[model samples]
Target: MKVSIIMGAYNTAPTLPVSIESILQQTYKDWELIICDDCSKDNTYEVALSYAKNYSNIRVIRNEKNSRLAYSLNHCLQYAQGEYVARMDADDFCLPDRLAKQVAFLDTHPEFAVVGGGVMLFDGKVVKKTIFNPEEPKKEFLARGVPFFHPTIMMRKSVYDILEGYWVSDRTKRGQDYDMWFRFYAKGFRGYNLQEPLLRYHDSLSDYAKKSSWDMTWGATKTIWLGFRVCKMPLRFYPWVLKPIVSWLLPKKLIYIIHNKKHNGKEN
Candidate 1:
């Protein structure tokens, strides 16, 4: 089956080549890469266009204005023509066999609408690896936090069709992936994360701070509330909805410590 990789590129010119190369070197050859540049001030559009020019399977699209990630993702989705839709980020790169393994899993298990894998978080050096639950992810799991990495996910094209693409709203600007997962769970769609780490997530302490900001906190809170309503979750799960707000209030250093503890001290 052919896989369509939808990547949103902003001002990631420094890492864009490596990111695109990772897809080009994938073990799975039957794939198309649709990279949509979000009107970056840098040369991101030029870099993406260069790749598209060299490869027939790769295409580059650009937003006239500086739309955010969700808008760029939806733009790429419009031109995707494959059985499965995979997501990529300009700052991250995947293992050569990542797509092969995910496509195989989805082909064998039709019940699962989405499949993602573990990720190795890195800065200048390898930080730590995060392994997701191998079993089907549940609504209870999502109540605590996102169970899968957004960029490492490969989902069925039908799943996107059913969900009608992402919620392109200002509310979801900072937490689009979180909102999308809740919608999937509410709709009774199941997902799984492979045990093996297949992607390299580039992040830093500053990035974590942005993730725990007021806007992200509010977005997560709103998404959880919507999930509860749509999925008919019990009131007991309401407490979990406060987690984002609580996390937002915590100091960035404390959050980093908690994150390090979760990943077990910066080792693969």
Candidate 2:
């Protein structure tokens, strides 16, 4: 049983080598890496192709126009031929044993449709903090936030086919993974978290819990409402739909100061 890793690469030219090198250095050798470049402004496609030249298991694709992650992932899925499909971020670092461990768990446990692990949030210089999700997260967990980290997840290829892959629309432009999670549970599938950091996620402290723009935040709020309908969540959990709105309304400096204080135990 082979695992196919699909990644959407944008303007990550400088980080591509290290991220791809992590995949090459994986303890599990029976895997293929499918990277779909999303018409990046930089030479991300060229960087990916350079690796495909030497590694037969690595495949590279490119979109004709600049689409978002949702479209890029769906395009990559068209060429994925594996028992399991793993998600990766172009700028993240994977642990050597991440693939082997995930494959082993999925091989024995047939009930769970997806599995993900904790992630170490880091910038270029230092690890900021570790976010570990619960072991068995039920649908109600959506009331707060995502149960599993997106880039750390590996799922049965059938699940993707059954759920019809990530939702590609204006509503999902900012929160594709979250919408997919809502649909995943609504369809009666189960998921698990390994409770250990399996990847180093690239999240700068300055960008913590902050959307780049008001439009993005509003889009996320839209996604939350859409997810609420998909999950058939109770009205009691409705307040969470306004979380992005509230967070976005706050001053950026205040948001950063609060986030920096919580994580670093002191204000930035």
Candidate 3:
């Protein structure tokens, strides 16, 4: 089956080539890369265009305005022509066998609409730790962590048609994948995760800088509340809506400390 890998590019010009090169090295050849640049100020568009020129299977598109990830990815969906659609972030690196492995799993397990693998969190110089995803996401997973590593996911294209892509809104600005997962499970779609890490996610030591932003935290709170309503979850679970606010109140250093302890500088 053909696979269409859709990625939304922001101002990640310096790291874009490494991400694309990793895809080019994939053992699975029946795939296309569709990159949508969301009005980046840097040479991100030019760099994507350069790849498109060299590889016929790679296509590039640019948005006039800086639409966020959900809108940009929806734009990529318009040009996708594969039976499967995979997600890729502009700054992450995938293992050469990622696509091939995911494709093989999905081909045999037709019951699942989506499949993802664990992720090896990478700093600039070395891998920090590997995060293992659960083999199957539970119903309560919506109130907990992400059901799947967004970048390591490969999905049947039909899932997009059923969900109508991601819910584009203010809440989704920071947690689009969370909103999507909520709706996916609500609609009775199933997903699975491989036991091993398939991608190197670029999460620098300074990731706390991104997490400390109150604006993003508030957005996550709104998304969680929205998810509870969408999934028709119980009233008790509604209390979990305050989880983000509680997390936001913690000191940034404490947040990193808690993370390190949970993962223990090794596989989690």
lDDT of each: 0.85, 0.88, 0.89
lDDT of 1 by residue, 68-95 (tens): 9999999999999999999999999889
**Which one wins by lDDT: 1 or 2?**
2
Question: Quick one: how many clashes does candidate 1 have?
Answer: 0
Clashing pairs in 1: none
Relative to the true structure, candidate 3 has a C-alpha RMSD (angstroms) of 1.9
Which candidate's lDDT is highest?
3
Position 147, candidate 2: lDDT: 81
Residue 204 error, candidate 3, Å: 2.1
When sorted by lDDT, best at the front, the candidate numbers are: 3, 2, 1
**What digit string (tens of lDDT, one per residue) describes model 2 on residues 1-268?**
3899999999999999999999999999999999999999998989999999999999999999988999999999999999999999999999999999999999999999999998887778898778777788998888777888899999999999999999888767777898899999899999998878899989764655446587788888988888898889998999999988887888877776665445321111
State the lDDT at 108 in candidate 2.
93
Per-residue lDDT, model 1, residue 262, is 73
Every candidate's CA RMSD: 2.2, 3.1, 1.9
State the displacement of the C-alpha of residue 26, model 2, in Å, after optimal TM-score superposition: 0.6
